[model samples]
Target: MRRIIILLLLLVIALGSAGAVWAHGVKITYTVTFSPTIAIEAAYDTGEPMANAQVIVYAPDDPKTPWLTGECDDDGRFSFSPDPSKPGTWEIQVRQAGHGEWLKIPLDEEMMQSGQGVVTEGGDEGFSTAQIVLMSACVIWGFVGTALFFQSRRPPAQEPGEAA
Candidate 1:
């Protein structure tokens, strides 16, 4: 009985600790419009928008300091006009509720002037939604399977007065 109780407690603790990680899966993607402004959209792997999340832009010229900092709008979208004087890869970071994602966009003098809209992917290259869900389920099933295996190997609980 004590062993079973301990196993159950371990399972609960593991699941509780993993809950935060499972909740924080932010992905960021960007698109350059015809106006030279770069637009970004942040969302969870589950396709849910990261509403009102914090955004920080870092110019390539000054990588250490943030060029601009702001929060995403209600739709998880933010746009900023990059400094044409600084020609290189611009970095953007989006963070919210313990989840953060980074994106890098390379813009040279010619590329910025072209004004050709192109959708680009960025941020953590993670598994798809289905893959994530499947992996999580596998982990949970592992715990349950181990617990059941141990429980099965144990003999039935006997009353205190029963003979050995």
Candidate 2:
């Protein structure tokens, strides 16, 4: 019975690790256009082939209705045109089988003002290089602190003949 329990635990651990790798391995890219037309393009992170993944474009202000929907190609690419006549910010929601989560990409005003892309209100826009750098630094510091915490928890090795 103990052997069976150990085997089951090992199998669970292996499967969990595999699932984590698969989830992090796949990357979704979203390119949204707000001007000339409201459209979106998507591709995989590794540039791997993709097919049949659903791409939904919605009004960020109103998630109840999606303006456009389409399936990705075998090349891991998908496109959607949401009523060109309607203007403003938009949000993209992407989903693929085995991905297990929805990927959300925002099209903000700065991207639209660039004269080639669409923009959505309240979406990320005009992020300066300094802001990016600061955010990156914060993330790095957070990871460093977490690592230090675990390292400190490890028990110190006792010297020979040391008291128990």
Best by TM-score: 1
Judge candidate 2 against the unseen true structure and give its global Cα lDDT, from 0 to 1.
0.52
- Candidate 1 vs. true structure, TM-score: 0.63
lDDT of 1 by residue, 32-129 (tens): 75457889999886678899999999999898899999999988999998977677999999999888788999888776767555544455556765
Model 2 ranges with Cα > 4 A deviation: 1-41, 98-156, 159-164
**Which segments of candidate 1 are over 4 A away from where they belong?**
1-22, 117-125, 134-164
lDDT of each: 0.80, 0.52
How do the predictions measure up, each by TM-score? 0.63, 0.43
- Candidate RMSDs in order: 5.9, 10.4
Best by lDDT: 1
TM-score of candidate 2 relative to the true fold: 0.43
Clash count, one per candidate = 0, 7
User: In candidate 2, residue 24 scores what lDDT?
Assistant: 25
